[model samples]
Target: MRSRIIFFVALIAILVGGYGIYDSVLKNKDKSSVVVNEIAPQPKKDSVEYITVWRTLNNIDRGESIANDALKREQMLLTDALDEGLRSDVELDFSPSTLFNRDLPQGALILPEYITRENDPGYIDLLVTEGMTLYPLVVSNKNLISDFIRPGERIDILTVSSPSSNLSGAIEKPIRFKGVTATLFLQNIKVLNMGGEDSEQKLKPVAGKSEDGFTTIIIEIPPTEVARLALAQRTMHLEVYRSREYEEPVYADVRNVMSNYIGIEEMRGSKNKNGREGEL
Candidate 1:
């Protein structure tokens, strides 16, 4: 009987020892898991005190390669006051100069919007960019663009669609349609070149006249809007107006253009109203 009691005690002791070992193993595993999680490096937010950024000296044109000497670094307090596109000197290596793929005005912040993968060493091509296009327009009118507006000028493009009218020759009672529609197609477009040349960046008209009587104009336009320009050129005519405004770049779509002319639509509406009054 004593041996049996001793056996029972030994069995209980073995179970207790096994439970203790299992509990210890479980605790050690949890501790190891916690340590592994804590191993991730946490950023000490307070350590970041200041940020260095670059600024522009003069007005920079699109696709113009930014020289290392033109930019001056300035330190600002590290805070959320910075914009998303703004660039910092700390992130990029300034040993190699970067190019601005877009226009950057004077006294503007140097931002990441100017940097793209294609903006690399050497001359920038206006033709190869994905969303950009080269639109060539021949302006023969000496009164319009050839003489006054030269290369490196921003101009507004006006378009008139279906300007021709039909006439049913009844001699005394000939039928005639008023006119086509006119709208502002483009505003503040970059003028690349005038008369096959950069026009020497001359503000005043050149000395002599051209024998061809036509000046070929090349402008930088987006690929998407080129189709509309093509359609307008085919169905109607385009006029160029010089712009002196130096505002930020603006973009528009074909939906913004509408027929608000007072010639046809307003006249028809007035006639319809008169007819309704006569019925009344």
Candidate 2:
């Protein structure tokens, strides 16, 4: 009975061991399959693209700081976004006043002041530096008073008594006369027929230039005459009258003057009553 029991126990042990080995093999196969399925492929990354943009500054007032106020904030933002991929240049335009504010057209830049050859062209570093005003006078086609008026030169402007009359009429029937001294831009006022040998009544403009094609004159008149001059400019043709005596005179020799004089020979012969056939 003991020998049969021992044999049966031995057989059961062998069967149990074989089943454990098979289960272990299955588990290992399952783990290998899961490891293959769980592996993730590397994700594709997109390449970053960069672009260039152009900009300009305009209407900056005179004496204003450009570095801090003009370019500080904008420059930081642009540089940050561009990350060394952007570049820029500055242009300055000067004028008398600020009236118009328009965005620069594509690929164009307008400056707040005139950048002369003397100004440094490197990157701007200061904020309290002086700048020129970007006014319409710089770009406009119209003439301005600064173009015509000069220093120390005298000018005449006819003042109008009535508000309706123009400058020409005011000069003809001058309600008043204003005498002004020309300053920097005196030549801007057209000096027409300045040294002509014609009478004042027949004085007409033979040649002239204006501040911007508009005739201007500087003469010694009274403050009250400004109105008439304004009226003449608006209504009739204004004439500029200049005295030859007051201006630099051109002297001619007596022989030259007598060359054109008629009957001068007769007068010379009469003076020589001796009739000695003198070389008159």
Candidate 3:
């Protein structure tokens, strides 16, 4: 009986010791996991504060290379402002070590051609580093009219009555002239006429319409030909002829027309010679 009792006590003690060891190992493992989590660094926020560099002049046509210079200037300005003890609620970031080598701002400013001259509050938006300086916006007179003229469009000419001309003659009838005929020429070749009518009788006449009493004829010309036409208009009295067929003004390819005149042998000697020339 004594032996049996001693054996039972030993068994119970071994089981209890085993259970304690297991519980201690589990607690240690949980503590180790928490320590690892605390040591790991957290990720930073992806967003940064942006500032505007205002008052830049319009029509600043510095090419793409200007981006680098603009960035350097922005950084220097920001650093100077910070040194002056200027404080704001915003958190400023203009670190050179960051992306872009601290050269430029995260945003850009697009300047206009002309600004209002009458002390009008004109401003441009620029992506600038913290503490950047802004200069007054400047503009050119040519840029003011850039939007008015464009590629493949009629010229926007602003004409005013001559002071020497009789005011009564100019204003009397308001010259209700409509459907005036005009001749259109491209490279001195008359391509089409303005009015739909074919005969001269149907074409109405306007008195004092032009200096010689002939109606002024306006023609749509390409940008390259604008200077040529301007000179021509000043020297020549433009006349309008009516046509039976109301044909749309068509532009011809001068190159193709010239090419047709070249003989087969001459075309073959040229750089773009194709074997199929004059084959048809």
lDDT winner among the candidates?
1
> Tens digit of lDDT per residue, candidate 3, span 1-280?
9999999999999999999999999999999999988866779877544333332222232211122333322322444445544322222232211122112233433222222211123211112223332211111222123132111122222222222232122323223122112234332222111122332421233222223322223233345655654553443223222223335653332234446534533544434345443321
lDDT of 2 by residue, 158-218 (tens): 2222333343322244332222112121112222212223334113332234333432222
Runs with alpha carbons beyond 4 Å of true place in candidate 1: 1-62, 65-130, 142-147, 163-177, 195-212, 244-280
Off by over 4 Å in 3: 1-4, 27-72, 76-80, 85-280
Kindly give the stretch of ten consecutive residues in candidate 3 with the minimal lDDT sum: 134-143
Tens digit of lDDT per residue, candidate 1, span 1-280? 9999999999999999999999999999999999988867878776666677777888877655456677777786656325544334444434222446677778766765565433354324632345677788755353254436655567887654433432111113212334444556788787755543322432234322443355556788888888887766655455677865535544332234545433444455343544652111
* lDDT, model 1: 0.57
Top candidate, metric TM-score: 1
Give the whole-model CA lDDT for all candidates, comma-separated. 0.57, 0.35, 0.33
Q: Which candidate order results from sorting by TM-score in descending order?
A: 1, 2, 3
Error of 2 at 48 (Å): 8.3
